[model samples]
Target: MKKPSKCQSPGDSSISAKENDAQSNRSRDSKVAPKSEGLATGLDETEWKSRLTTPEIVLKEIRTLEGVSYYHGMVARDLVESKLTRCGDYLIRATDNRIMEFEFILSFFNKKRIHSHLTIKCDVEAGKWALGLLSVNQFSSVVDLTNFYKTNPIGAGFFLKRAISKGKYMIAHDRIKYSPKDDLLGTGNFSDVFRGKIELENQMVNVALKTTKLLDDTMDPTKNVKANKIKKEMIQEAEVMSQLRHANVTSFFGIAVDRLPILLIIEFCNGGNLQGHLIKFGDRIGTNERFLYLHDASAGLNYIHAMSITHRDIAARNCLISVNGFVKLSDFGMGLKVRRNESAEKVAEDDDGKENKEPKLPVRWMSPELVDTPDAFSKMSDMWSLGILAYEIFTNATKPFFNLDDTDVMQTVKSGKHPPLPLSMGPDLIRLLKDVLVAAPTQRTTADKFYNELHVLCTQKGALSLNGLTINQIRGISRKRVEHVTYRKLSYAIRMVTREIGVMHHRRCWLMLFGGERSEVSSRTGSF
Candidate 1:
């Protein structure tokens, strides 16, 4: 298993020849690749083999198939259907979807303006290959099978079509070591983060193996299309991650497209995530110590925000704890690279003004704008979640809105209120939270300001006091308090009651004026 630092065509005869030999050894005498994995004593062979990209697989199969001009591996079916016109116009494309038993997928544009995909499979027992089921004819090899189908109509009255192989997408894939089932770190809807190892430069390095299953049902056009899209995004994610460099930001090792499920290798944190650390030891931590953790995270946040990348998912759970007990932000599944001249604040301007209404989000740490429609995550959303992260630290990771249902969390956000931080926190810290937790994106404190202030406070409490607060600065304590911290949520309740009372008083005044005036006028008329 050679890991190249750069991209190469896996279809190269030499590369395929070597890989084919290795693959054959793994399978007992079967000419085709084995579909399942069997346990081995030392390292898992499947993990290493999964590093083999699509072009390698196709080249291995067609190594001896004569007259098959070009091998275009792992092409999207949509591109094939649109480009190939006329009935019987056909092309062969490999799929990253691992489920299909294949020589290749035969995509033909039918007369009905639609495409039909027929799986080409091999029967190891007969040592023959066939196209389409219900066909009685079987050929000695895939080349012969494809030749037979080219001229003869199966059941659909279809005739021979040109075998077209378009431009191939080839790239050098990196390497990843197998992560055992027991070493799995976490899971997500589209990807899983495994505690795994990879060889970097010359030495072994532990990494967060973020992977999505590429070996699924490719027969379904929708599923295959989606799998490919995810692959593209994974590649794009790697591109974005490469630009980020900061001690507080989790380091990206590289991405591997060589295997069935592609790999995005990230720096693994040994102390687990900040959320877990807070839950276990937050109560025991002092204010200054907690500020140090927030300070570390803000430094990372400040760096990425400057890079023009929006880490849509930012929270205590996403923030990993390093061996030194510092906070490093992780998890970029929802991250999007901001386009040039585009501001993250403007991206969140909703015409409908809808907030994320999802009853429950992971850890319930999402910004208000993101909660309604996941698509509307603004660039400034990182700050919103940072505020939540601060709360998690202050509260020692106590679950937010514990008394409120998840549904109420959305409602709470809609009403321009958030689950408050502890009033017992230092006044300067409360004021800082006030600056960040605001609903308006423009009003929220900038990451630069947040990080700078926190950095100062971490060294000495109330060190961020301004010129106006010289007395407090001299005392080394912030006399300036966030007066509303204790009564902010109460003000919301008070506002509602006062509004009701004002409406009642106005209604009574209007009724009295109308009734009293009419009675006085009637009495005067009767006396006259």
Candidate 2:
């Protein structure tokens, strides 16, 4: 068994002696010419071969019969359908797309450019398959093509199995099963999010399942096209989600494609979103507690920025609060990866200007630059949203630029005016908001630096608690009273320890702490 050279043509002497000699000379010259000199000219035994950008297997057959004429190759196999086109004097194009035996004809028409004058022929027969060719240079083999459609955030779309095996975050869709009729968490243009459950590491946990609508079986052609577009967008969102894993970021379990409308299984937050939390708890929550949520949101934003991602839509509604009081950022429809030296306008805007129509953007939260060019979303633009988020938190979910339309908000921001800080906000919190809310995107503070500053302010405000007591609560206690409470606790611990252990063992514990032999300690205490 021997492999063939690239563009190798078989021998044929059916043409005139002069043409045969010309063909022979060209064959010899082709061997010596640079392989990069892909296409050359000659007749029936000539080996002027150009490397077709076809699949590896298809190229092999094409090279085996490059010298054969088109007429004879077609007659040799009796193929159901065939096509021929004279691209130039040097090249001939042939294509076949019939669901029949695996027989491929490889031949070309003679140089006289007459359909009746067929000079040579070669036949290739192999295993069975049929592929339609939209172009002469493209080929799709069984091994290279998969029936299933799949995509991820950072790589080319591939078969479902390959996607799962290749990506670190990808999981098999079969591993997830959801209730057909469940409480719908939310709905979007092309998807409906439902509360579902999935088995993770042998534990059944609640998850949010976002499923894309079925487009393949749509009755309307227009809707079918739109559905496909939405499916791609959702897959892109899933791709970004798979790459991310942070304490303050929502977790993506995997994609469920075992059925219609691909499903994205994600971690469920019991406390809902920051928007609802503020609206419900409003006046009952203190300023310090609100700062804690702000800190969490900032931490998430910083993590995403470190990974070079711009969460184009950042607002209170996009932030989720866990039942345990942890805040995680969610919703990644407008997320985009930053490229080196790319301008905001190029990276942020969709080329088609379709993102502006459906799936509305946060108008009041958007920065001046983003307002002008929606695609100009950057880390700085995210900072602007963070400012709005802070205001929403402090004001108990009050809408930014309340009662003002999109135009009003844009004009006000451009005029160097911003929402006033809530009366409850201290000087430090107000300063942090000012840094993020600057009209100029370039002047805005970085997410990490802003996060650090807010963290410090949070600590200063006694937003952090120690052993169930906030610093403020602890401050109100008198020193003598605190000492009395500490002494009582100490006595209680000693009594409990003595009851749990025998007297001899308890004496040994004291001796170990005091750096004395148990015998000596017992003698001094006159106990054991």
Candidate 3:
């Protein structure tokens, strides 16, 4: 299988892992694979034992072939999707029950940005393998079959060319080592997070280890029955996360499954979550700082939308603050990949057979449409949440509709009612909020446009601010002013432009612009 990229970027959040699910028998379901090292080396003991142990290393003995994409454990469906990035990107893995009708899996990326995971048929007596339930084309070995398909396209015009290999960051080994963890970051219903250093061969990367509590319940037979179901969902989320590459989005390190105490590891952001950061340091965040935060967030969201992933839950709490102060979107437990002309499947698909439980929805952050059809989250819904996020930043991170209960808040939210700008960031923010906080989804501004506007807004240095000035006074000014000299005037943000020019000159310039008498408008000098 292709490796997940280590490049940094941004995106959004989560809560419900899944609906009661069952073990899905589907094959590959990803759309990423770069021209890569492929299988740099044969599958060694370290690789084989990490994934599958019970099967007895029959394939490991075939040292001549260590082709990538072959797996021996569970969640092969997810693993395949995470790694396949391009057309023909493929992998083959041993089926959970190889002795059954199907012996292996052949998964590859499709040009349509979807993925295909096909079951491979085998004739044990003939020592041959073929595609699907039956195929006229047969090969002596799995590697030979994969090689043939690289040049020959398969179902729906997909070519199995670039076989994926797990890079250093994505740990699949059950016994992979790491340093003793320290510094508890946070906790949730199903996990406890701690800051730690993960051991890689060449170096140690800072990481946040979130231990999954659901799978550790060994005493409950009922729980064990849905273990694979839960793992499949978890694996699906991690795989989707694996494809995220942005500085504003927290990176997924890997998950240690096929063992106890399965840890969901990711990049460590020491500044904690954006919501807590704002609550604790609201006084420190100002207009410029707020703009920077929004700018970073929008950049992340833009990338997320570009990738066709809808962050079902987007709020200040879901955004993480890096130590360097960049806003990164994280906590993607509820993300959904909404591809063009395709059904919007969630990262973790709902399983009808699993236990029934009430979903703890992020009501305040949700759009009205989501409340109506909870599963139908989209980019426009995310835009509505972005409007709330802007409100959070300007309001010093205060919770919106604090006066209303969650159930009651939905009434206000559903009616297209939102709080007015409680604090003055600028009119740019006001304009942004107006564009996003609309009842009609089509009326909302896209994250791409948000990013572009912020790009300009974030560059403002307050050298030409005209905030709070009357429209008449602004209209009165002509070409010879300080603003016309160097910078574009701010629409409505606090500016210390007068400080750049002398205060006397600033007053005189303003007076002169308004047609004040020569005596009233004092002689303004080019000199300070």
Candidate 2 clash pair list: 69-120, 70-108, 153-239, 348-375, 349-375
The ten-residue window of minimal lDDT in model 3 covers 6-15
lDDT per model, in order?
Answer: 0.53, 0.48, 0.53
**Model 1 lDDT tens row, 1-528:** 212111122211111111111111233322433443321111255543443333333333543432244334344455456657777777654443333222355677776766777666544445555554533666675567667777787557877577764432222222355544556786443345778665445555566766553323222533444445555566667766755545577766566443344556677777677777677764566665577667777877765665556786677768886543446788874334222121222122211224322112442566676655556666567788888888888897876666676567666765657677887568888888888888887789988778767666654674332234222222222333211122222323433444556744433332332221111112333210
TM-scores, in order shown? 0.56, 0.53, 0.55
Q: Rank the candidates by lDDT, best first.
A: 3, 1, 2
Off by over 4 Å in 3: 1-72, 76-169, 173-183, 189-191, 211-229, 334-359, 461-528
**Candidate scoring better on TM-score of 1 and 3:** 1
lDDT of 3 by residue, 1-528 (tens): 212111111111111122211111123324433322211111233332332322212232122232232542334465457767876677654333311111355666778777766666554445565675336677776677877887776755666667676443335432233322235576442345666665455455566766544443222333332444556666677766656655577767676542233456776776677787677766755566666667667877876675557786677877886544456787775233211112332122122234322224556777767655666778999999888898897777777777777667767777878767764866766876788888888888888777667666666655223232211122222212211111112211112455565545444443333321111001121110
Q: Candidate 2 regions off by >4 Å?
A: 1-168, 179-181, 188-191, 201-203, 212-230, 334-357, 414-416, 466-528
Model 1: CA > 4 A from native: 1-94, 97-174, 188-190, 213-219, 334-360, 462-528
- The window of 10 residues in a row where model 1 has the poorest summed lDDT is 12-21
TM-score of 1: 0.56
